[model samples]
Every structure is written in C-alpha cells, then in structure tokens.
Target: MTCMQLLLYSYPYVTRFDLRRLMGQKIKLTKSTIDKLPIPQMGARVDYFDTDCKGFGIRVSSNSRRFFVLKRVKGKLTRVMLKPYGVITPEQARVEANKAISKLYDGIDINAEKAKDNLKGMTLADALKKYFETKTLKPRTVENYGDLFRLYLDDWLHKPISGITKEMVATRHLNISNQNRKAAANNVMRTLRAVYNFANELHDDTLPPNPVKRLSNTGQWNKIERRQTVIPAKQLPQVFQAIQKLENPVIRDYILLLLFTGARRREMACLRWESVDLEAKIFTLMVTKNGKPLILPMSNFIYDIFNKRKALRENDYVFPGHGKTEHLIDSRKQVNAITQITAVEFTLHDLRRTFASNISGTVVGGYELKRLLNHSFGNDDVTAGYVIHSIEKLRIIMQEATDHLLMLCTAGKKINE
Candidate 1:
C-alpha cells in the first residue's frame, strides 16, 4: 500500500514495534506510521493523534501540539501540553505515544467519554442562557440579573462553579467597592452566591459556601434604607384634587389607580382586565418577584376607576401601549406627567415607596410592609415557612392608607388653589 494509505489505515494502532521499525527504516514513514496507529473508526481525524501517557492515557493533538489532556466524566476535551517540539526528545514522544497505545489496548474510550461529561467550570456567561430559561423572575428583575452578570462576572462566568474560592468573590467585591459601587459590589457578591448555589444544586458536587458570608461580617452588605416618598396618608385629598385639574382623563385615572392601590408600576401597567376580579374586589398579579401570584384587594377608588374605563374587547389590557410586551409598558411617562402637573419629583416606584413609608411606623411592622410589597422574607431558621397571616389586617391598613392619600389629593381642591 502507498505510505499515505498505510498511515490512513493503521494510525492510532501504530505499535511501538511498528514505530521503531518505521523510524529505523529511515523511509520517512509519515503515512505508514499513521496507518498502523489504532484509532476509533468513527472519530479518527486527519491530523489527530492520541497516545498513552502517565496521567493522560489518550492524548489528542489540538492545533499540531502534542499534550496530555484530562477529560474527566463527560465534558469537553482538555489537554496539558507535554513538551515543545525541540524541548522534548523524539524518544520522549515515542514513550508518551506508547502510553497512549497502552490506554487504547486497555479498552478505554477516555477521550470520547470525557467529551460527554456535564458542563463544569463553565463561565457565568456560558450558563446564563440556560439559567434564564427556568427562572420566573419579572422582566425588570431578570434584566437586572443579566446586567450584573455582564458587568461583573464576565471573567469568572467560565470558571468552574466548583472552583470558585471565597477569595475570588472577595476580590470581585473589593474591586467593585473600590470603584465607589459599594451597593453594586454587594449585589455582585450576592449574585455570585446565588449562582453558585444554583450550580451546586444542579451539579452532583457540593458547592463552596458563599463568600458573601464574610462580606456580612465585614459590614460590606448594608441594609438599604427603603425610600419613603409616598404622598402622606393625610395628603391624598389634596393630591386627588390636583390630579382632577389635569385635562387628560387617562393620566387622571392612572395616577389615581397608583395612589389608591399602591401597586407596583409595572404590575399595574401589565394588569389585564382578565386578571381583575371586580366582583371579588381583588386583582391578581401573575408573575411577581417572589414567583407567586399576588392577590391585591382593590380599594373603592380603584374599583371605581376600573369601572369608568371604557372597554369592550375580550383581550384588552387595562392600560394599552406600544411599549414592551403590549401592557402599558412603563410608568415613567406617567410619573413625568404627574411631576409636571403636581410639581413632585417622585418616580412611579417612589409611589410604592411612599405607600411603604406611610404604612410603617403607624401600626405596620417592617414584616407587614414587606408583605404588602410582595417581598419574600429570608429563609432564616426561625422565619422559614412562616406564612403571613395578616392579609386582612394588611387590607385594612392599606384601605386606611389609600383613604389618607385621597384626602391629600383633594386638600387644595379649588382648581388653581
């Protein structure tokens, strides 16, 4: 057979004896040596070579460099280069080649088996797409997580989740903190911990404990003081009066709905008429940050506002818009509108914040405020699984709170007064 055919036929099966003979023969047995090598019938490649080595029984030449690759379980093939062409003697290559031959004879498909292993040490970016698929987070929340990963975890995402050290987390925190982003740094650490925890659950291995634990000790993670910007409970009447003077009926009802229900901006904007049960006096928000359907009882003002909205279409949203996903997209424009009319510098979110503020310190505990805001309490040993048994109590407080806002909006009600 021609040397080319010989090399093509035998490669990977080329024995030490065969190599010896070919090298000894001085016939430049390029194709002959390859033809004798024993390669898997299906996976054999033109430039590929695998040989037994001390640790790596199967070595594959990637880009013409010979190396010892450790492909454990089922994963992508990885290699450790043995020696440079001129650095290692041909005898060394032959010896290494023999080791690979030995491994093949032992009937181990290490290369192929390793190629099938689970994704370990994958970067954050590599696994995020998969992560996003199963998460039920709100769009804004999911976007925030994506932003954090893109901004902070670019270098570390590809790191095997198993290999992330506390030091690495601390270093990332330090870098972000040094950049005058203490809150962002803490958030990064928090995201890392959450991702690692998720990976640990998915992987069959134990995850390293969160490094953020140390951050808490160092006071790096601070309790963010909630912003309290709600129009006062007693200030709603004046606010309502001011709202009524606005010429746009849509803006009038929108601002009233927000002040009355204390609903999150997006939650109210995305509200479907189908999700509202006017007879039951409750509106259901299907996808909340806590991944639970939130049932919010409507106040008299909210019910009346919905009652006045003119609609007949079966699939019509309460608020329609061309913004993202067809719900009255964002409340920012409404916020700006209200600010221009009422001369207040508050965001729609600030309305929720105002709701929280007005409720707290007046027969409403932080825990109660959290419930109204649909926040999930931490899984503390003592607090875990403790259901909020105060929905009715919350409703009464919210009713009182909404009534208070009504008084504020109408307070200075004489048109321009």
Candidate 2:
C-alpha cells in the first residue's frame, strides 16, 4: 500500500490499542534491534523498557510501535507518548527520554505536562460533547448550544480548541456579525466561550487559553443596540384594525394578546392551558428563562383572549406548531403581513414595546409598568426593594392598561347614533 493509504487505513485502529497492557520488560534498545522485534497479540500492547534510560520505553502492538516516556509523580503513574517507531531512531528516543526523565527527577510531572499538551489536538466539537456530558443545562439553553455549535459555527467544529487564536475568534465574530447580525454573532461567540471554557478545564495547562477572552479583554465585543421600536400611538388603531381583519382567530388573538400583555413570543408560544387561571385573571409560568416562575396578573382582555385560545386548543402548547419544533416557530411572516396592511412596520417584539409605552405615564407608575412587563430592573437601584406591588394593586394597573388598549383598538370606529 502507498504511504498515504497505509496511514489512512491504520491510524484510527492504531490509536485504539490498549497500551496499558505494557508489561515493562527492560531491553538494551537500538533502532535495528527494535525493528527486528515481533508484534504483540491483536488489540494488546507490550512495553519494552530501556535499561540505560530510566523512563524511556517502546510500546508495540499489532498495528504499530511507538516510543513513550513513563514517570511516577505524587505516587501516581503517567505515560507520555513521544514518537512512532520508524519515525524516530532509538537514539533520538534515548536523548529525548533522558531530558524528560531528568525533569521528573527534579519533581516536575512530565506526563501530566504532556497530557495538557495533548489538548492542543482536541477539536471544539469534541469539547462540546464533553461539556454536555458533564453539565446539566436547560433544554432551551441546550437547544441554543446545538444551534451555535452545529448550525452557526459548524465551520469551526473541527478546529482545535487550543489552536483557535484570538485573531481568528475576533475576525470570525466580525464576519458572522456582518453576514448574519450582531446578536447572532454575540450568541455564537457566547456559546463558543462556554465550550472553550469547558475544554480549558479539561486540558488545563496543555491547551492555549480561550481565544474568546480577547473580545472582552480588548473591549472589542460588539455593543448590540437594544431595539426600542414600538407601534406609534396613532398607528395602534390602524394596527389593531388590521389585526381584526385577519381570518384566523389563532393568529388574530395571538397578536392581540401579545400587544395587551407584552409577554415574549416564545413565552406566549410555550404557554399551556393549565398555566392560565381565567377566574383569577392570572397566567402562571411554572418555569421561565430566569428560573423564576411568573404568577402574572392578566387583564380582562388577555383573560378573554385565553378563553378563546383554550376552546381552539388541539394541543398543550398555546400556539402549537404544525412541524418539527411543535410550537409556533416563526411569526415573522404573519407579523410582516400585518405591517403591510397597516403600513406600520413592526416586529413581534415591537408589540411588547408598544404595551410598555402605551401603559407608561397613562395608567400606572414606572415601577408598576416594570411589574406588568415582568422586568427586573438592576439591583443597584435601592428603591427597587421597596417598590413591590401586590397582585391586587397590579390587577388594577393591568385593567387600566387593558382598557386603554381597547380604546385604541376601537378609537375611530363610530357607533350608529
């Protein structure tokens, strides 16, 4: 077989040999002498130690023989693979092994140090699998990891975790940001950061430190703009009227409820019938992104919307998807259709912004607005501790917001006198 084909067929099988079967029989090592030696039994390895070099040895299996150094540190034994036989002369192994053994004598753990260096060959994709095996993550967070690693950053999966340079990460982040969006780039790098950190802990000293850190260290991480788009006050009536014209009650009520409550799209999409308390006018999210379950007061309008959705419910999910994800996947097209009809260009999140804006300075205090939005203003604000509002107080605030939205929805429609 050709040299390239020989390596291609044998490399994987050679790496699988149980080198631990090494019996450590000492021999006076030489290149010609080692070459003349017989191969061991299939799947097993035998160690031929050198009498002249204390830690120097050669491991021979059926497929290949390799030179290695072994040392005992802190009462634990470790082996460091050096070079494959035929690639390195026995004299070369002897000289290299002497230097490594001297370090062991000086109390340095050469094998452990070598182990750290082995991390340089481990790919980012391998680290992700190892991280998943070691950590328990939220399902949504797990999904995000899959998206970042497998979908978005697939090109980098095979690259060594330790080999990813700071320049590579920075330029890649910038490229992804330009090609996709800033948020996508940020999230991709954030997941890369997590996977890189796990691999660093796994390899410790051997691999190069995380390249993702350069973004933070140099303050070059993209400062993403917080979108503040909202349907204008004058456009609310036009928007609501367009929503009213939609044929599907599912999409209609879905858009209306979002405008009224300002709950995130995924939060609303994942809602279940059991979480809704119609009589109490409250929606309970048993598990939320922040791990805090929301017992949010729903205004009469949202309560009425839920009542309609409940009757149409064919599944546990509030907005059950027809395809693989099994939840309302993307409402971008539905939202864009509404935008077209009303000439009010808006995102689903804009409905959230609209809810907050319409209710602010109109029906309740700023703190109450934050409460209605289920927002946690930073803990740095001392008065945030004392501004807690009860459900009854929040209910009053929610009712006012609901009533105001209704007026906007019906503003220009005159009743027959």
Candidate 3:
C-alpha cells in the first residue's frame, strides 16, 4: 500500500508506539520532523512531546501547528503558549519553553505577574474612575473629589499612580499651603490617599505604599482649625436685610430656608416640591448626605417661605435654577454679595451652624438637638439609643427656636432703626 493511503487507513486505530514509528521516532522535535507530523482529523488536535525538552511540545491541529509548554506552577499544572511553529524556529521555541519552565519552577505565576504589571501602569485618572465605579459615593462627594483633582493634581492625572512619589506629594502640599489654601491642600492630599488606597485593595495590593503617608510621617500636613464662625444673633437683622436686597428671590429664599431649618447646602439645594407638605407642616429630604431620610417639621417661618415658593414654582426643584441639574447648585455669588453689603462674612455651612448654635442646648435638649440635626448616634451614647424623638414632638421645639430667632431679628431691626 502507498505510505499516505496506509497512514490515513490506520489513523483511527493507531497506538502511541505505532504513531511514533510512523513519524520516524524523531521525538526530539526538529524542523524536518515537525514538518512530517500528521495533521489530526478536522475537529481534533494531536500533541507531540519533545524527547530532548521535557514539557516542550507541538500541537498539530487541522488548520495550524503551534508550540507550547506544559509545567506545574504552584502545584497546579499550567500550559503556556510560546508561538506558532512558523513564527519561530524550533530552536527558539525550545529556548523560550525552557525559560518558562524555569519561571514556573521558581513559583512565579506568569499570568498574575502580567496582571500586576498592567495595574502598576494604571493612570491616576483611570484609578479614580475605577474607585468611583466600585464604591457608592454621593454625587456631591464625587463632584468634590473631581474638583480637588482638577484644582490641585491636574498635572498628575495622566501620569501613572506608581510615578507619584512621597517627595512629590510633600512638595505639592507645601506649594498649595504657600498659596494660602491650607484647607484645600489637606483635602487634595486626602482625596489622593483615598484613591491610592482603593487602587491597592482592588488590584491585590499591586501598587506601592500610599505616598500621602509622607505628610503624616514628617508633620508636613497643614493644621487647619475648624471654622466656628456663625452669624451673631444681633447680626441676624442685617443679614436678613442684605438677603432681601438680592435681585434673585430664589437665592434669597434658599438662604432663608438654610438659616431657619439648618439643612445642609446639598440637601436644601436638591429639595423637590413633592417632598414639601405645606398642609402637613413638614418637609422630607429623601436623599441626605448621611444616607438617611430626614423628615423635619417646618417652622412657621419656614412654612411661609415654602408657601411663597409654591405659587412661583417653576420646576420640580423647590429652588429652581437654569443649571443642568434644574436645581440651585451654588449660591456663593449671592452670599458673597450679602457679605459685602453687611460685612457679615459667612458660608452656607455657617448658616447651618448659626441655626444649631442658636437653639442647641437651650431651645432643645441634647437628644432633641441631635435629632434636629439628623446626627447619627455614637456607639458610646447609650442615652441617645434609648431616646426616640418623634416629628410631632420636634415640631414644638422647632417652633420655639423659630420664635426665639424671629425675636432676635426684630430686636436687631429696632436697634438699627
């Protein structure tokens, strides 16, 4: 019988010995022997091992022949492809196979090493995006983080996180502090630290140690005192008068509501009409910074403001704006205008502080004050855990505080006049 006809006829019943003899027993794979290896059936592949190199072999499929190495790595058998037969010479494939086998014996996981290399090359911007995707962050917090990066670390956004050294972070912190932005410098570094920490944990600690720790290590961090400024009770009338002069009624009422209710800037900014119940004399903040729904009773003064806004309602937001969010995002310009007019400098947060400071210990008990502020109870506050303040009960305390505040404003107006 012809050689080709005999090989095809005996293919189905061929033993390893018979197959080896058919290929001339030259198992030490050379170009000539590899070229003579028979292709398997259309749907199958045949593995031919090299006698000279233990674990080095060639896979002959119906369509192609590829070089491969099989070895046990970390106690698990693993196969790694070198290159196609035509892409490299048999000698080159054997060299690469030996190198791979050495690495495997040394307990180096090649796949994991490649993954670590890829993560090490991740840019700061990409890492931040991955962090945002993996964590549930508030929109305001996300915006704040974006602002911190843009304002301080814009130059480093495209650079790989690994390239950011401790010296660089320390120098940047000093430069920002020299700009009279000590608080901003601290915030930017804090944000960077969070992003780096997230990346390390996400990538199986592939990244270097967090560079921001240098600030704490060398006392390079800025010591910013917490702002305790509040609108003095005597300045209430002047502040109210300045707010009333604002051309934008939306902004004026927004500031007034913040002062009276002590709601956070974002919570009050994103207030919806559906969340306000004028008839029920209450308002609900469906989404709060603390991730808790806040149901607050509207004081008479706050009720009047909501009533006026209802007649002039322009959209879903209580304080509508022309911005993309369809709600008031920032009232800084108007607040700055008021600050200029009255010379009573304050921030939006200061308004909340003013509300709390005025009525905290006197107008409401400590438990009631905590409830009014929607503050989470600490683990050590055993009394707070037992006390439950209902909205109806809080309405009385809120009205009393509002009355006290209005009296102060009226007394100030009389003195001014």
Residue range with the least summed lDDT across 10 consecutive positions in model 1:
22-31
Instruction: Write model 3 residue lDDT over 1-417, tens digit each, in one string.
Output: 654444555476676567556552328789999998876667666677899999899887888999988887767998887799999999999999999989989888876777787887799999999988988988878999999999999999999988899999999999999999999999999999999998888679767799999999999888888899899988988898888779999999999888888889888989999998899999998768788989999887889889999999999999998989999988889999998998998999998999899898879887887787788999998988789878889999999988877777677344236
* TM-score to true structure, per model: 0.56, 0.70, 0.75
For model 2 the local lDDT of residue 66 reads: 90
Candidate achieving higher lDDT, 1 or 2? 2
Candidate 1: where are CA atoms >4 Å away? 1-121, 133-141, 155-181, 197-219, 233-252, 278-282, 312-315, 340-343, 356-404, 412-417
Backbone clashes under 3 angstroms, per model: 53, 1, 0
**What is the descending lDDT order?**
3, 2, 1
Better of 2 and 3 by lDDT: 3
Stretch of 10 with least lDDT, candidate 2: 15-24
- Most accurate candidate by TM-score: 3
| Error of model 2, residue 299, in angstroms | 2.2
lDDT for each residue of candidate 1 in 254-320, tens digit (9 for 90 to 100): 6667656667776776778888877877778765656677787766666777787644332467777
Return the TM-score for candidate 1, rounded to 2 decimals: 0.56
Per-model C-alpha lDDT, please?
A: 0.60, 0.78, 0.86
**Model 2 superposed RMSD (Cα):** 9.5
RMSD of each: 10.6, 9.5, 8.2
